[model samples]
Target: MFKRSTLSLGGTALCGALLASGCANHLQQRSEHEERVERKLLDHTLQVDIGEPKSLELPQRRIRIHEQKTFEVTEFEVTRNYDRYTPYQPWRELYEVPLGAVAIVAGVGANILNVFMLGHLPDSVTKDWIDNGVAGINPFMNIQSHGRAQQNLASIDEVQRDRRTESTSLPWSERPVEVQAGTQSYTLTTDRSGVLRLSLLDSPFAEQDLSHVMRLRISVEDDQDNVRSDISLPISGSLRGKLLEAHALIYDDLEDDDVSQWVHRVKRLSELGLEEEASELEQSLIELTHNDPELQKQFLKSLTRDAGRLVADPQASN
Candidate 1:
């Protein structure tokens, strides 16, 4: 009898051990997709686009960077089985259920009235109530929201477990970028829009001649190295030459020059496609020859159409 009891007890113990081992194996099992995701590397980069106007000096200089950091990201999404009505407020649903029933009745009556009135009433009047009633009946939209579920968008923290290699965009906004041009280095900050507007005259590049440099290098600092580390922005030889000439004109003694010389400078800037600078110089000329309408008019008149009609329309010279 004792031997039989011992054998029975041992068999039960062995069965229990087997069950535990099976459970452990099931828990540890991973799908092939999960394995692939774990091994996958999400592509990330700071993409720079040379946009319109092509002037490095103006704000229209479209050096826009689409910065998306989506590499090796361990995604942690707080998830659980939620009903389709998860977005609806709890207390609101209680009243909404009955209100929906009433609204449905009202909609039916409105449609009936529309039929009786021989389509005198607008379709929207009946349709709006019907739609509203259906939504309320569907138990999806809540009438009033205290915004409890909306808070999910406001914050994210580790919950449950971390999911690896999920593709998502990490915003590259308001980041300080370092640009190096020849011997000069400037620290420029990107706006919230991720656009780097290089104020050529405002920055150190103004003092340093850009005509000599082949390309300027901009480095994304302090962040992930997996992204585009160094971006080489090419400086066109023609633009560089124009900038050099523009710089010389800027520093030149415009005040010392007589009317003809000033007119030549204005026309030169316009020819160089420096319309903004030309407009500014025209303003200075206006101030210089203050109250002399005839002088101002004559000066503008002497200018060819290529000089721009900032003051008045000028006849173009062949």
Candidate 2:
């Protein structure tokens, strides 16, 4: 009997040890899971998007830069709150029971009296108070967050960081970027929309020898952070031909051709996407024709865009 008692005691002790070991293992696993989730929530990435190819004729705009940030969310939690209404509110039973009983009796008497009266009654009079409490509430507006994303989002922002989210794309507004074209390098700043705009004629490309200039290289670097990008574009052969043709037209006088050529070339150049060249040539055309009303009208009919923005003399208006 003593041996049996000793054996039973040993078995009980073993079971207790196993239970404690199991509890510790579970807690350790839970702690490890929490650590992994925290690490994943901190993961983030930034992507840079320069403008797409400007057009089939042009490679890209003079400049453009936009940024998008991405966040990694792994494990998260949320709290739910609701005021579910039903006819089974036991807490209001004391008052509701008496009211419901009275309502049924009144409804029957009213219906019987309606046999001689109008014979029609509204549903409110027949419905019991318990079921008709705010009868048919609109659940649409009832669902609301405690506050702005007041959920496990707070836990996701473990560092209390006020960072941009992917809900909307944010521009790299008013940021300075470095651009290098050929032998020239310049610092250009973006606009309010984070778009960098500079006319090719107004940029360093104007000074660089285009006879053999074949590629445009753009680089954006930030010393304060890890933002950086390098972009290279090939100056297509067709683009070069158009640029040189426009340049040649700049030196040739508008009067070198006949009277019928008053502004035809200007119109043609503008059509070829050479607005700056067309604009310069139109100035000569204006002087050649002295803004004669008839000729001005002819030019006006032919002109479009920048070349057309030139003013005709008061004589034309008269």
Candidate 3:
């Protein structure tokens, strides 16, 4: 009986020991599982350095880097979505006509008008005179009237004969005509109109070869009537050479005596071969003439005559 009791007590003690050991093993496994879960969560948290960890008891939100050295929390529920905006096309709204319709219509209208009005009417008409005459009045009549209006002209032969007769009768001093012949000189009379008669002279050259002298009468006319006249008889051969030399001397004398430096420069430039430069100088001379009218007029007339003589005598270019 004693043995059996001892056995029972031992059995009871063993069962209790076994149960306690199992309970301790189970508790140790549960503690190890919790530690592993905690380590995993801590590892994830350690991956990011969100400054000093503060006790921010707010809602969980995603943070993004906004700019340099800055972070912003964006809550999904708080942000609003907007529709994308697009601009309207202007080409469709601005253009009214179909591509080239305006140009086509204008060209067709012009062709129709041209076909209807050929040579009957004037090509253009002002708005003020649109209804003054018939639309297709004959334009040929306008041309015919213009031609008929230019039929009358002055009698040139009678005028020349009268001018010649008047020029031969005047005194020598009042109508002074100078002829320079190789250092020798001769004087002649002029008409009432200051024109010198060339044909009336009974010279040795005139009897033999009349063509030696080119009789040029320069007349200043006011409204188709002669107001003033000057005759230039350019002699041929050695006489022409002497006259040209005398003209050159006269030009040089005037230039040397002139007080204005501008005139001196202009005269000097005219002697040069610069036509464009001389023309510009002439324009300046014209302006100067406005201040001294008579002097300017005389200078211009002399310069013009000199230029005319230079043009007529091709040998003068050499």
Estimate, for each residue in 1-318, the C-alpha lDDT of model 1 and write its tens digit: 999999999999987665333211011111121111222455666666656534353312546666554546444434332212124444455777788778889989999999989988776668767765765665445532233333222232334345555555433468878889887888888888877877554446778877788767878754555455576766667777788777676567876776677777888877887777777777777776666667766777666444545564222321
Q: Per-residue lDDT tens digits of candidate 3, residues 145-207?
A: 112222222222111111111111222223344443333345554455443433311342232
Give each model a TM-score: 0.47, 0.42, 0.16
| Per-candidate local distance difference test | 0.62, 0.52, 0.33
Q: Identify the candidate with maximal TM-score.
A: 1
Number of backbone collisions per candidate? 0, 0, 1
- Pitting candidate 1 against candidate 2, the one with the higher lDDT is 1
Q: How high is the lDDT of residue 199 in model 1?
A: 51
- Shift of residue 264 alpha carbon in model 1, Å: 1.2
Q: What residue runs in model 2 are displaced by over 4 Å at the alpha carbon?
A: 1-56, 59-63, 70-168, 248-264, 267-295, 301-318
Model 1 residue 174 CA deviation in Å: 3.9
Residue 103 displacement in candidate 3 (angstroms): 57
Q: What CA RMSD would you report for each candidate?
A: 19.0, 18.4, 52.5
Predicted candidate 2 versus true structure: per-residue lDDT over 22-140, tens digit per residue: 21100001111122232222322233444556322452364556664455434433333322222222234345445555655676766666676785666545443223232212111
Q: Name the best candidate (by lDDT).
A: 1
